[model samples]
Target: MTDDTVRELIARSNRLGADPRNTNYAGGNTSAEGTGIDPVTGESVELLWVKGSGGDLGTLTEAGLAVLRRDRLRALAEVYPGVDREDEMVAAFDYCLHGRGGAAPSIDTAMHGLVEAAHVDHLHPDSGIALATSADGEKLTEQCFGARVVWVPWRRPGFQLGLNIAAIRRENPEAIGCILGGHGITAWGDSSAECEANSLEIIRTATEFIEANGRPEPFGPAVDRYTALPAEQRRRRAAQLAPVIRGLASTDRRQVGHFDDSDPVLDFLAHAEHPRLATLGTSCPDHFLRTKIRPLVLDTAADAPLDEVVLRLRELHFAYREDYAAYYYRHATPDSPAMRGADPAIVLVPGIGMFSFGRDKQTARVAGEFYLNAIRVMRGAEAISRYTPIDEAEKFRIEYWPLEEAKLARMPEPKPLATRIALIAGAGSGIGRAIAARLAAEGACVVIADRDAEAAARVAGELGSTDVAVPVTVDVTDPATVRAAVDATVLAFGGIDLVVNNAGLSISKPLLDTTEDDWDRQHSVTARGSFLVSREVARAMIAQDFGGDIVYIVSKNAVFAGPSNLAHSAAKADQAHQVRLLATELGTYGIRVNGVNPDGVVRGSGLPAGGWRAQRAAVYGVEEQDLGAFYSQRTLLKRQVLPDHVADAVFVLTAGALSRTTGLHVPVDSGVAAAFLR
Candidate 1:
């Protein structure tokens, strides 16, 4: 029966969580009581199973449940350490575990246990918080829900609030739920079915109430001046602003960014009152956890000139940091956790929309989504009554809570390339593809750029996710396509940091046999391609004002004199020289340009499939399969170089090891006496 109850609870939790109308992502808890056999006592015991700390309701499993003896959980009140000492109760909960326990219990555990019901659900539905945060919340709750739903004044979730809600539930037997003031909602029932029904009733009722009683334009009507620009114009503007925003937002540490111009976001931003409400910050703990205390609202119009917007952004970013530092000092006590960062997680541009930043793409994207949730709450709150949020000091307390600090401490350390974004220009296959995978493993977001769009997309699919990597087609020789790829990268992430210019073709022929077309094609793909990619990406890197890396995969033949490799070798030499030139020019901007010279990258190389291998084999008088061995035998190391070896050199160059090293060429060849740079 306990197993069955856990299953039913999971199903119900999924249903409630699947609907955004019921709860925001990972912002709710559900629990159920059932009979379990006690091994020690050899008797039937009632157990409580509740969603544990940091567990998401939509995907909750048996492992996500925190099981405890129901009797023991209820008895916690007898030893209740009072409101001021409520945090101690969380520690005491470990002693009440039914057995070895499941997951760590969340702060809302006692609220689920103390209520005299078989089932309970605590959620953060926007509609519920809308009513909860209204200026006249209690009156509004009474009017919206009648006698069936009770209203509790604002109290941060903890042992004391649990006890208060339990008392309310006991006194009002007719009530099915409570609108938790300045928070969300809690519903309880004797059965799972009854609990779900009650939860749905609260959500549906609140939503219907807001729709019926709220003003037509809750945001006080959209200002035509702040309305969304045309799609193409908005995208161009967003791409222009994303890198600068990412660079500023990463003032403390590096951060990935998300650009949002969804209908809801645009609608909210277009309203005249958005700036006033955005400054007040969010009310819910979950919302504020991701959004920070408040967003940095861009003071300029969306369609303003690019130069004006960029200048204002710098001013605003500086002020935001100063204000944040002041906020920390004003409320931080000796016991408070150290300041995390002053950079705003959410940035609002009146006509543009929102830009949210985090340590990773998903986190950044989710932060934007949470701010949208804040928008929903604000819209509803204003239509019926004034928007009221928690006091600023209280927000500080929650933001820097000791427990929150501990949670962050438990998270795994970020990968070496975690916040770095890379552009692998020829990542469809071979050396380029290997570098993409290597960087992805180290936690870099990558853009797979190749002339073969399908091949680029295929490699991107194999690498990771849309958030981790994206694909774009670009002919290295074409300036238009190169610009498009670079712009796509900025739009995909916030900007570019790591770049590998590895696109090249080989035409194995003696200088006498080499045709003009062969020379032009080889140079076009290798020399011209590298130059074009570097030039365009350098612009974005300069605009971001953040130092970056560019690596060219030049071949050993670039320096070593080799027969039947005229066009290929000359183009390779051109790339090698470009590295030195760019490194010299871009050094002032903190951009490091380097080169990797590899010998005979035979395994997993596109050259073999592109007819270069057959030509090389014919010239060497060796069978097609023996070409690898022939190349290896001539090397001092007697080992044929592979794509992975080149990738390793690339990683070392950009992964902070060679931070100060630029205009240098590191050889990835096993060993080549003549090829070694003098």
Candidate 2:
């Protein structure tokens, strides 16, 4: 006879929507049962009943019950191989119960039969499903349940899973219940009421934890209106989503079985920052085996080609798999079983809810349920501290145990330009632009700041094409503008890596003919601008954990002596002194300050212009064409110096290759300064 308490518990499970059977959709399931052994004869007793397939728990009756002799069941388990021995055990139980025949047993009957408690029940609750869907789910579950709960990492159910539980029970007999990593849970007790109570207690704990910690703060005032599309638009968009889903699934004829546009869950997820969405992976590895780590969040209609979407998803999956394999090889033991394969357990379809793959419907349902719970738990825990998933190496060790050799084989490589952000002042043209472009190409996101707005925009546009250039128009001499540009660059790309102080003005005149205004114009952009920009960038670099590189574009006048060009020479010399002082002060912060002194570079063109050639020709008493030849022959390289030559020197100083060389002048004048000194 069916126990009244068992019937009531089943009724409550149905009311709460925990009845798996009735909830079967394209991807869902439910299961429940009662537990007991005969007290007097030590025989198996059917003290309670569970709803069978094709029936809802709310309407279940005694006919749905599958009974077995308690003592006979125990005896069969004592010699059974595990759930793998299901057919044999079932046949034996049927023969033993011939006098009182019943309907077919539930698929999990072997597992439930192994539980030693008097009462037991299991169900894949929706709430539980939502919490098992992210990277932080385990820690979140622990926080919610305290220390009493036993966490079973993802294992396929049936014989293997049952064996896993049996082994655990042997070690920790006091475990109140078991929480399967990418599945649901199993509760057991001495009576139907007590088992239900345990289930409810776990559920309550999970719910409270979610209520207290799981929800994300609303992404303050939806800045983008596309996030709040109307209902009709959402429907139209979902139709577009179908094709992408099909392509991601790699099934051309796949149809949408159900649509959930009104889902607040989808809306909230759609509005989340791109970074957060990119980082969302399944809560557990078992979920990885089925749903993969992340899903494709789509909003477009199902009829679109979806080829691009599918290709992107495949690329992400391949990357994740490669990362996982690398990690496995890093931390695995030489002989662990987890390192046996390279297949990923989950695949996240953008715009659609998670899709779980398994050997059959039951396995898929369990995986999906577990992923859902991971998501909810991770979302909750993010409210406390942003959930940063463990790196691929740590995850690899957990996923595969025999591949630790991979991580140990490689030497640690330093960053291409460690602790350096290169800012190119007056980067709109000539030497400044060339230096900025070269620095950015070398893995630094360059900040191009110039007084000319159009020139700045043009240079920025050119640099942006390569993804590492950011342009800002700022009059370098203005302290406010200099500070703003520095702040903006740091905000845009984390921190300052290097500073290329290339903004300066030049004028040729005798010392007696130079005016105060000429000196002021030259010094303001060269000496004062370089000093202020260096100070600001240096301050920012020191505030950051990593230090940086600073290079000043001084003139050859500071050393080899330019024609008594009063204004230019005086201003450049002052800038050289400022660079030395900066080098000393910023040394404590690991910032290296240096100078690049280039000679005869025309203001607009990197090469010497016609005017510059004529002037040089007059200085050396030769024709303009002969001047180029004259300078080219005088240099060790036998070639006129190009802006790129100066840029290359700037790169070496900024990059860590010359970490030990700082506060020194690097002249890219083809041994011209050496000739002068001689």
TM-score of each: 0.97, 0.46
Model 1 lDDT tens row, 391-428:
78988888998878988998899998999999999999
Q: What lDDT score goes with residue 653 in model 2?
A: 84
In candidate 1, how many Å is residue 328 off?
Answer: 1.8
Task: For candidate 2, write residues 259-312 as lDDT tens digits.
Answer: 333343344444445236435554433344344445444333223345554455
lDDT, candidate 1, equals 0.91
Instruction: State residue 86's C-alpha deviation in candidate 1, in Å.
Output: 0.9
List lDDT for all candidates, in order.
0.91, 0.57
> What is the RMSD, in Å, between candidate 2 and the native fold over all Cα?
22.1
Lowest lDDT block of 10, candidate 2: 21-30
